[model samples]
Target: MLDQKFATLPKLILQIVQMLQNQSPSDSLNEIIRLVARKFVGLGVLEVADELEIQEAILRLEKEIIDLEATINSASDIKLAYAHNSKLEASGKIVFTGQGAYMCQVSAGGDVLAEKKDSIFRGGRLIVTGNAVLNELGSPMATPTMVEFVFGRRILVNRVYPGVSFRVGRQLFKVQEGLQDVRVAVDEQGILRVDYLYKEHLQ
Candidate 1:
């Protein structure tokens, strides 16, 4: 019975061959021929499907590989260092804070530096030279929020909102809308100067 059913396959093949011969040269015509050949000649359906599935799997895997590479490139390294190191003893302002109980690691650029754990923090200030990031050693529950605090000489101003008034020290300053440029500076005394840290230091 199966043989009889398949006996007409030759006729079908002949029809397909004729169709291929008369077909116009187009992208779709080539795909139709491939489909007809695979279906009519008892061609390996499993192999064809497997090849397609493998191709799809390979594409997905390649996408995943690319995503992983991007993540690695953007990831930060956690290293351990001392707060009293000469490298951090320059003249800059600390812009972050962490819970003192846990070991703190500073993330500068892409490298991580582990610093000693301290509980008693006199103030949330790390005066050093250049732009650097400092954090608690452990994976803390929250990202360190940059708050306006008195370090030594320099003043840090964050949370700049448009159409709002800011209270720094004892005076209040009103901010105007559509302000494109902002300048911060420090004077001989503890005052907010007009300047900006446009670029980061290369460390």
Candidate 2:
């Protein structure tokens, strides 16, 4: 069980800080440790008197977060720019208006906009705080693109192709087929589920 949790620790760390900007990196790291403890307990790993093993495990997780700190800190709390058009990689409140298909891997501190009608995110994601306006998300195949919004709990799409999924607060929604001018949200309940969103999801 300890090994299982250790193996999943890296993935958990990635999700914890993915697009989660505007906060101090140190604070985020601290939060990661706390979350790790809770995850262990939830996963049926009881509290052990062998605190050394846990400390070592947490130290390893800290190094993982440190490596990710550059990418996390690259984004600003406010609107930021995309580094390259080819990769379509950007973060921090971006407005992208492009054409054709591309691996649009975006991370934002707040909102994101895919302005043009031809802007397509073939196999990527739009992770943000509030809303994200996109022309297209996901491919006709594969695992589909992901749109994760927590604050506004809304995602507007001009043309949402098949194979798209969303993670709004603690709730999860997926688009198996296509749709046009779509608006996805978790309703009013998203804000009230503070336990799952903050404590559980963050856990």
Candidate 3:
């Protein structure tokens, strides 16, 4: 009976508790301690005295596991935030547009505009065009003269008529008669700066 109880106790605590179902409650604690001492020969009779300490250690380990899981979740959230910031930093395109604003298609230097499909401008000589126009009595009077932008150097166009212009550094030079504005160089630091041209009409 002692060997059987010791074997059952080593298998599972639930098995030991089931085995004690037939025993009186008053003798169950002593029987459990004997079985535990027999299973762990080095612990001897001290198993009964150390039961509360063992339970405390188990509780501590469970709390530590829960804390470790929470820490892992926090690290995952930080990684996700970093990834989102990286995506935002990599994106180099106009996100918002007003009533009379336009973001033109981007192409590589010396590439044909007809082949350009992606609108996100990155660097090098980029062709920017306006799609906003003013109509007078069902007739298109004039399109947007200048395109105010924010990137790299401060570029300002005085009178931007229908023409293709090239921007080198902070200077804007007319190139051809078309609907494209070209940016010559890319910013080195990747820090975005504003370049705006405001024209006020006085009556």
lDDT of 1 by residue, 39-65 (tens): 434643334444444344334434434
Candidate 3 per-residue C-alpha lDDT over 82-195 given as tens digits, one digit per residue, 9 for 90 to 100: 111122211122221222112233321111111112222221223332211111100012332222233343332222233334443364544233222322333577533322
Which of 1 and 2 is the better model by TM-score?
A: 2
Stretches of candidate 3 above 4 Å error?
Answer: 1-48, 76-203
| Ranking of predictions according to TM-score | 2, 1, 3
Per residue, candidate 2 scores C-alpha lDDT tens digits across 32-150 of 56756664656535664465666665676767566666655675543323323343344456676555345556666667776667776666666777567777666556447777777
TM-score quality measure for candidate 3:
0.20
TM-score of 2: 0.48
Best by TM-score: 2
What lDDT is obtained when candidate 2 is compared to the true structure? 0.60
User: Which residue pairs in candidate 2 have backbone atoms (N, alpha carbon, C) closer than 3 angstroms, thus clashing?
Assistant: none
Clashes of each: 17, 0, 0
Q: How many backbone clashes does candidate 1 have?
A: 17
RMSD of each: 20.4, 17.2, 20.5
